[model samples]
Target: MTNFNGFQKLIAIANEYGIICYATPEECLVASLPGYDDFLLAFSWSGAFEGEPPEHELIAISIQDITKEVTVAAWQIPTYLFGNVLRQAQMLVTAHQDFVLRTNNP
Candidate 1:
């Protein structure tokens, strides 16, 4: 079912932002942001009836800080809202990377 072109397109979009994603044997999509190892995005889909396949998906983002031993989770997100959420996540990661670069250079 994940062979759908749309799925591939989503993977491509993630890759464009330096996010690596793969499908698990159970069909869940797991993504990781390069250079920001603390954040993870996991996408899962349901609502398949009679093998008709699901038209929408759910997303969950997990953020962990090992130094502080804290974990933040955002889950049960609909795909319709994923675009904005993804963009925000990307911006946050980019900002963090920029901060790291500046601090290391100074």
Candidate 2:
């Protein structure tokens, strides 16, 4: 089974920042603004459903509502190194201005 620890950390960070994190069979989606495509972040996992080693690639989709902007960012991780990518993702989400704390975990 794909390791979920990394995903858990991502969720924790999202919650701490008041972002909504949703996990599905294919990937995880994080969003800070409701009904706004510009504030949505999607993390697509390589080995999400199959029982195999975790794939080290993340597809970050950023939508810019103003000016009709859309950006696609791709980061590749070496084998057995997903934590760094997770941290980077968290940092990216936290940099947004509309962030809020969504969890009470200390």
Candidate 3:
């Protein structure tokens, strides 16, 4: 995983690559729906598939300082590395959501 300096850098990368990180629970859940988008939600919705994934999208290292693993869209992760596609979907949702929060409120 890339040692990011901060969320701003991640946001920069996301913006440059057209990486549409879904930042909403509904978006996350919606992206995870297999038949809904043909499983495209497992990845970034905008099709920018290059670069080291933003930390929010990294399954190995999810949110820290939390008492328990947080659920993203449709699966549990941040504590285990074996989460499946569902977890990936949730991760995107969580990451994208976080991105929006940071960008909007920063």
**Which candidate number maximizes lDDT?**
1
Model 1 per-residue lDDT tens digits across residues 1-106: 3556656655655566556678778665677644556666655543333644243554455444334454444455545555565666657656655776798998
User: For each candidate, C-alpha RMSD in Å?
Assistant: 7.1, 11.3, 14.9
Per-residue lDDT value at 1 in model 1: 36
Ranking by lDDT: 1, 2, 3
Per-residue alpha-carbon lDDT of candidate 3 for residues 1-106, written as tens digits (9 for 90 to 100): 1233433443444445443444433222112233223223322122223574533343222222122334333333321232354445445755756775898999
Better of 1 and 2 by TM-score: 1
User: What C-alpha lDDT does candidate 1 achieve relative to the native structure?
Assistant: 0.56
Worst 10 residues of 2 by lDDT: 97-106
TM-score order, best first, reads 1, 2, 3
Q: After superposition, how far is residue 61 of candidate 2 from its true place, in Å?
A: 5.8
The better-scoring model by lDDT among 2 and 3 is: 2
Error of model 2, residue 59, in angstroms: 9.3
Q: Predict model 2's lDDT versus the native.
A: 0.47
Q: Candidate 2: which stretches are off by over 4 Å?
A: 32-39, 44-61, 64-106
Q: Model 3 segments beyond 4 Å from truth?
A: 1-83
Model 3 clash pairs are: 23-96, 23-97, 73-90
Q: Candidate 1: deviation at residue 72, Å?
A: 2.3
lDDT per residue as tens, model 2, 1-106: 1557766755665566556667767656545344444544554343333554444334333422332343333454433453354455445545432233333332
